[model samples]
Target: MLAIETKQLSKSFWKNNVVKQIDLQVEKGEILGFLGRNGAGKSTFINMLTGILPPSSGSYALLGVQGPNNAVKKEIGVMPDYSSLYGSMTALKHLRYLSEVSGKKVSQSRAMDVLQLVGLEAHANKKAGKFSFGMKKKLAIAQAIVHDPQLIFLDEPTSGLDAESVIQIHRLIQRLHQQGKTIFMTSHNLDEVEKICSRIAIMKDGKIRRVGTMDELRAYYQSTITVTMKHAPIAATDLATLEPWLKQVGAQLEMEASHFTIQVESEQKIAEIIRALGSYKIDIYRVDVDEPSLEEIFLEE
Candidate 1:
């Protein structure tokens, strides 16, 4: 079952199009990482999906129910990029109020349960205004899930969190997935998304440039393999000796003080490059091939 679906969804403000004809889908129990550079319309799209902002033109469905429907809204949860909790209210009160507004008949125990789930139970009685940014983020997340919504939208949930807090949030998200909730989250941190997301959509210029599993994105981009070799310093005169072998294999070589780095098209070509270098009597002390990181793929686009 698709927990979320959008078709030709778009939004504009003051004649400036922020989101342009986006189509996306998230299946039940799947975590879809919505990725983009800032101003790539990730937040705008989330706002539209959650009905926090009305789309200028388009349509969406949440859990098989069409958008702008109050029935659908009751089953959807959203943790925005900004904290929406009441500042003067205690964490416990804030959650209880939200649960009440959700019409779910949540008890104090249920509020504490979500607080514990988010690791904020120790500070439950503290006012939200006194909470640190990370703690407040946790509170907002706790409130979002208090109603046990089937689908959750988290916008930059790990942003501004310490390493431990980030891990806690990641684990909480994973646990939600285990409970069969669909998650759609936006983040500029590709590494974090890469670790937790089952699939990802890369957005650029207000349109989705690519959407697929990480392996699919990597394969589609054809990541470059960098091979580093430790060798004795080469004389200016001897540099020419390595040029022919490098040229024959179409490898780009960069020389450092005592090492050479060769970037090739793929890992399979490394053996041939090694053989070519061996034929020239170049002592190979070490060879390492580095795969491309997510940053590399984004920049290449």
Candidate 2:
């Protein structure tokens, strides 16, 4: 089943089109990484999906129910990019109030369970206003999932977390996914999305520029292979011998002490270069090939 679907979804404010025609879908039990640069309409699209902002034109459905319908509202949870907890209330109290508002009839035990799940149980009695930024973010996420919604939308869930807290949050998200929950999250952190998302939609200028698995995107952006080799230090005379071989393969080489970095079109060229180097009886210690990161691909666009 599709957990979420949109067709020609769009939104406008005043005379500006914030979100242009966008078509997207998320399958049940899948993590869809909604990626884009700032002002690229990621948040606007997310808002439309959650019904926080009505689409100017187009259609959408959440968990099989058409939009502007409240039937599936209870089945979806949303954690926005910004924290939205009541500062004056204690963490426990805030969760209780939200539970009542959600009409979930949750008990203190349930609230505590969620707090612990988010690693905030120790601060349950502390006023939310006194909590640190990371703690507040955790509290917000806990509140979003207290009802055990079938699908969850998390926008920059790790935005303010410390390194340890970020790892903890990633693990928690993975556990939720394991339990058959579908997650649609927006993030500017490419590394985080690469680690957690099954598929990604890259947006730019209010439109989806590309959508695919990480491997697929990487293949699309594949450039020359970067090969770094650790070899014995070279002299002016030895360098002349390497120059002819480098010219033969049309490879560019950079040298620093005992290291040589070569850029070649493919692995076959690397093998040829290695063979040429071997003919010179030069010893090679290591060879490393660097591939383009998702950030590289996004920036290139």
Candidate 3:
């Protein structure tokens, strides 16, 4: 079954089209990383999906249930970018209350277990008002998963978190995946997305630009690549034997004497470049292809 699906989903305020015709589909057990620049209507689109705000036009379905409906809400969990907490309430209290609201009633021990899962067990009795920014973010995540919903929407789960906290949250995300949950998350950190997401969908001008795995996204933006091969230091004389062979394969040799860079546009050219190098019998040690990272692809024009 599809986890989430949308068609021409859009939102506008006072004639400002925040979200445009966005047709997106996510499969069950898929981890989709949603990407967009600031002010690109990413939040608006997420809110619409999570039922916080209604779309001005179009429609969406969550787990085969159509909306505007409340039944789907129980099947989904949402960790919004910002959440309000009662500073006076303890972390344990927050979890229990959210669980109850989600139609599940658990003992205090269960609540503490959830807190421990988020690494906040030590501060269970501490009031959320006094919690650090990272702590509150953790609490938000804990609440979202307390019910163990089938599908979860996490917006910048690592925002406001320190390096250590980021690592901890990543592990938590992995744990949820192990339980076979579908996760749709948003993040500006391409490295983080690359590490955890099964697929990615990028938004630009309030519309989905592309959606695919790392290789698919790379292929969409694939252009000339700068191949940097590191081997035993090359003398100027090495170029004579190597350059001719490269030329034969329509590959160009460039840069300093110790190394060479090949400008590759197609995958076939890259293969030919490697073939030429292998045949030359040079003392090759390493070859590095300088391709665009996920971040670069998101920012591409």
Whole-model lDDT per candidate:
0.86, 0.86, 0.85
lDDT of 2: 0.86
Question: How accurate locally is residue 123 in candidate 1, as Cα lDDT from 0 to 100?
Answer: 98
What digit string (tens of lDDT, one per residue) describes model 1 on residues 167-283? Answer: 999999999999999999998888999999999899987899998988888888875667888865665656777666675665677767778787777667888867866766667
Name the top TM-score candidate: 3
Tens digits of per-residue lDDT, candidate 2, 94-168, equal 888886776675789999999998999999999998998899999989888888889999988998789998898
TM-score of each prediction: 0.84, 0.86, 0.93
**Candidate that beats the other on TM-score, 2 or 3, i.e. the better one:** 3
Q: What are the clashing pairs of model 3?
A: 87-129
Off by over 4 Å in 2: 232-243, 255-257, 271-283
Pairs in steric clash, model 1: none
Candidate with the larger TM-score of 1 and 3:
3
